[model samples]
Target: MEFEEVLNNLKLEKENNLAQECLNEIQNRQVLFHSGFEQEKKELTSLYRLRLKTAMDLNRDKFEEDVLANWKKTIDELESCSAKKLKLNWVRTEFKQFMIFWNSETKKLEGIFYLYPKNTIKDQEEYNTGIINGGLTVGSKKYNKGTFIKEWK
Candidate 1:
């Protein structure tokens, strides 16, 4: 499966499980205690929150590991071949795009990078078009918070 699809599935599973747990808790509370369950409810909520955060952290770590491993494999393959320039795009809960080029003189892969926010397709296309041509002119759009100028070193 694609990386993005895997992420989406993971998220959906988490949400569904959490929702079901919440519904069950509500039903149990209603059946067990009609008057004095406030403290217990608070404690349960706190525990659930902690568990939720831990689950999220684990998922994030797994996702990052998968992404890095895939990237290493791709880079290794490129190095073995005659590929010159490659553009890689990823949406890591947001949009990120970067380019790498094989530098014959330096005997290395060099990259120029730009990050873009997850936005409407029209906006994304317009912003990426500017980047591909050369560089984005200063103060071009409102979604400038996602733009980052960096190089792969």
Candidate 2:
């Protein structure tokens, strides 16, 4: 029974990983839309990115620390979230948004450093954890939750 349980858990983990990968692919595949709508979307995205960049560049240390703290606080609030079923998500901070998730398989808390230009609720921005640009450090590797801010500049 114990062996069976372990196998089931492993299967779930694999499924989760695959699902995440699929989502990443979708994010990378840019879509074409009506010229007007496309232009509007692009403008909004650019505006948000600019704001997020300015916030981070102004005082990188403060932005990083605050983002990390908010992510941790979010994790703390999720009663059901744990290493076994830990899921990473983007939580808002003063300047921007940061992602936090625990990869039980890797035994490391992963931080996705993305500068979300706007509030997630309005944008519904899909997870692009693969793209760690804009001076943010996002990757596939595991990270320590405690020292997340210092993980990247």
Deviating ranges (above 4 Å) for candidate 2: 1-39, 65-153
- Candidate that would win on TM-score: 1
Tens digits of per-residue lDDT, candidate 1, 33-126, equal: 1111112323433443464355446645533444444344444444454434332222221233222222333323322222233465355545
Report the C-alpha displacement of residue 23, candidate 1, in angstroms. 39
Would you list the C-alpha lDDT of every candidate in the order shown?
Answer: 0.32, 0.34
Best by lDDT: 2
Score candidate 2 by TM-score against the native.
Answer: 0.21
Q: After superposition, how far is residue 95 of candidate 2 from its true place, in Å?
A: 15
- Pairs that collide, model 1: none
Clashes of 2: 0
Residue 39, candidate 1: Cα error in Å is 63
Q: Ten-residue segment with the worst summed lDDT in candidate 1?
A: 30-39
Give a tens-digit lDDT track for model 2, residues 1-153.
121222233334444543243233223322111101111323433444465566557756555565544433433433333333333433333234333343435433332343434434223222333244454544321122212221111
